[model samples]
Target: MTEFAPDAGFRKNRKLKDALLQHKALSKDGLSERLFSLLFSGLVYPQIWEDPDVDMEAMELQPHHRIVTIGSGGCNMLAYLSRHPSSIDVVDLNPHHVALNRLKLAAFRLLPVHADLVRFFATPKLSSNSAAFDRFIAPELDVSTAAYWNGRDLYGRRRITVFNRNIYETGLLGRFIGAAHLLARLHGVRLQRITEARTLREQRRFFEEEIAPIFDRPVVRWLLSRKSSLFGLGIPPQQYDELASLAGGGSITQVLKQRLEKLACHFPLQDNYFAWQAFARRYPDAGEGPLPTYLRPEHYPAIRANAGRVTVHHASFTELLAAEPAASRDRYVLLDAQDWMTDEQLNALWGEISRTARPGARVIFRTAAEKSIIEGRLSPALRAQWHYDEERSQALNVRDRSAIYGGFHIYGKAA
Candidate 1:
């Protein structure tokens, strides 16, 4: 069992530093990078933004497959268990995420009923949540994980109390959404109005009238121009550059507007929890709308039965792959971590991924721009080992309910 620890010394995390500190200290970009690292060292996502349904489809997960993925909010890994993967290895650099993943896994194992699980994770501000954690979840957690929940924040509130309140509105991304809501309110726009739409046309109407014009505001445009402004979205400076380039030298505000439009209008609110989180700041009430796959009652039995197969690690994806035997893993879900990697880091990551991937293994990832990041960056020999499924990638990219990513890519190792 890997013992989790508090994130008090995240500065000492060399892998995280190497990934974020690309510019010189005191430099404009460097300062932004440092600040993002500080914010990210804490919980970034209360629930991950990527669409696990699309990911599972792209990977073609099977019962015999051994999967390795970046465990952002831990939801995707739990969702993957619904497919009955042989096992899953979840890696992340943030201790908070590591602790959260462990807590979810423990909850699945010990929580008495599906409704209990829903109350603990889905419903917000329920005072019984912390008590449920103590009675059911805590005994199943490792010592360090229990310590993490028991530990108080700077405000002196126990970390577990977030469950008793609104966990969705508590993380960096959560606070980012809250700030967006505040900005909308200042402009006389109620962001939550989009959630009331009953149809796609109604959704589009709400977005055009209530949401799209915010990007045109002088203050909003100016703020969007700064790379640091998107740090709350977990987008690093390099990824911001990629997104800006997508506008063909135009204002990034336009690019952001287009993406936000997709998020708000592309999918129906009843089906997209991502939209609910962005606008409403919480999941829909049971039977009110769809929940994440892992949170749904139908999937709970499968997830709980297979929960033990997941092993959480506080490390980088490449670092974890390096320690595994060659050709051992059959599926890889990179999320958007590659957007933060440099050419050299990309090569190192692919080198290990190529080495550790079993024959016909599939790898899936998302990008900030409408193209694969590895196009010309990966070394030829390593790139030659995998075949990019361009058509399916594009199809999946369009189907992705998250709608935040510009591209969704899948690569299959040569058989």
Candidate 2:
């Protein structure tokens, strides 16, 4: 797999009409299993979580804890595995994501060696080594997952084609980015050109000169103001309100600029490889370490050791919590999953969490609002046993990364 760069030339207009139709029709729910099953569906890429280091910092996890988290894209599951916890239960509602996680775990277990796995996932272009997949990864996948990868997309292209090719523009967030890119192109701005800058100084220049100018455009501003518009990026409605409030007018462009500004300016461009991926579409190099260390060769021993401690489930958090033994889990990572729920749903989820959480257990989650989602909502009995670290959580909030989010919270079960 060649490291996909920002300047990777896109095949212009291969299926322009279809892309437009899907883009227009991708409502709030967007891209169901039926759609994914029919689309260029291969085992999607393994990497999914954002800022593992930041997440760990926020979590303050201990070695002895058993954790539960919403699996989402599975990046965090692998990352937490690196911490060597007693156990982790990852549950998700998305079947595609569940399959992706299972495939990743299988790859970790069956790959010939770590470097082989690293090269398989981190190489610049995947087509360069069909042998890697055919020989190791493909064989390891379960039958259903294998079938998924064999499926075709809107363009009638097989999902496996993404490996030999770059499909950075495919996920929910990716599609939103594609839409934003097209809109930028229409307004005579080229995001790809700016995103390709090699240096921090160059990145700043691009953001200020090319990217910044687009925010002032009337069409961009109007579209950005709508709460439902960012569903493509997976931002829930309540979160959109919080993010909009952060921008002073809820301008998506403004919020994006502010967040990208941090990625571009706060950390060294070399160290902040995540910035490179967001802007440049690739890692700096292997010497910088595999894109995700838990997926890398060096940590495979730890991952393998901890892998057995995990159980992956496709279910709602509320449902999962209800079935778990009382006072069993020590750590819970909700990961902004609450934003998708209604008030009644939130109450139900927390009620079970309160019952299942052991004394001294810690729960961390992000929300679409700046305040604790449970503060006024949880039943008095449930809320009373959980101690909210308000001041610390506020201090830990990274405005730039969370500019699109409402808040990050940490709570401890009162002993």
Candidate 3:
């Protein structure tokens, strides 16, 4: 377990920092260690990478289901609330993430209406969001979480002031994407032009002419080759190994190019806000672009109605599950966190998952590789208790608009 400084945000995650260091591909490299330290020092995800639409289709969350998910950007968990789940437990190793989730819940409950919430999140340049926070949501947050957003940065400005800017461009991933845009400019490519393409052919043309060549640049490939360089993507060192193996002849740059292309060219720009955020550093529109389900206007009422159902905490999956009674949880959204675990960690996690999972409960996760990490890793007894939904996983992976992962996997507890 990590000890967090109540007002320190993510920089206080001692355990997570130690874990990532141990798993680092180049553990002895002082440079990698330092980069990992800095990367984990703040919120890594302003938007989650997993596609909740595909996840929702796979889980088929009933009104009775109890959902547990890794609270990345807290988007998908809020998205799940629209299904009217009985309860949702969202945990994160990063305190900043837990604070972010709590802040979202508070905003949903405190804001006058969905429009105010949208303006708070979607319209980043508005000063009204900060005012809304002070007037409505501030009184509702826990002491620690409120302190996080209220604390001033080195620049002597309130951290919450980011809401007055483009809040989506406010995290490690956001800065990474912004850096990518700068790099593209250096290569004489306007990455945003891909968003202008009206058809798949035009998208592909933009990629080949603008994006693909950026990947070929010497500096780009050099940076991509370093595992530390990818920490901004929320990829840990161990997952870097998996991505390397799957990158077609050990070229991780090639793998990133393929994934980026999938995000940019395989889906229509109007429909894939993931692409828009990646290139443009903000959604295509303030309230009209393809937004996350939780951020959309129609889903806002349901989210507010059920926002109280979510309980955010800072803990590991196994630790959280072990605290619950057997057959207590029904749906699991692990994201790609398992890729950072050891074989022993994998077995232990599955062991706890199998124990806590209700009969017919579904466990869904993404892998940096196209295969689930369960095979040949867990005891046969433990593995037999769950059945893999291979066909459905494959189908859903294709439908995943995020298109950032190699595979989407689902496992169901045998009835």
Best by TM-score: 1
Model 2 weakest 10-residue run by lDDT: 1-10
Sorted on lDDT, highest at the top, how do the candidates line up? 1, 3, 2
Q: What does candidate 1's lDDT look like per residue over 1-415, in tens digits?
A: 0112244543366666667788898998889889887777677888999999999988888999999999989999999999999999999988788889999999999999989988998899899999998888887788888988988776778889889888888778888888899999999999987877999999999999888888889999989888878888888888898998998865788888888899888998889998988999889875557999899888988999999999999899998999989989999999999998889999999999999989989999999999999999999999999999999999989988888889999999987
List candidate 1 stretches off by more than 4 Å. Answer: 1-11
List runs of model 2 lying over 4 Å from the truth.
1-49, 128-130, 185-205, 245-253, 287-290, 399-406
Output the better candidate (1/2) by lDDT. Answer: 1
Q: How accurate is candidate 1 locally (lDDT)?
A: 0.88
Model 3 pairs whose backbones collide: none
> How do the residues 279-361 of candidate 3 rate in per-residue lDDT, one tens digit apiece?
77777675335777888888988999999999998888888998999989999999998887777888888888888888889
Query: Which consecutive 10 residues in model 1 have the weakest lDDT in total?
Result: 1-10
Q: State in Å the error of residue 403, model 3.
A: 1.1
Instruction: Supply candidate 2's per-residue lDDT for 272.
Output: 58
lDDT of 3: 0.82
Winner on TM-score between 2 and 3 is 3
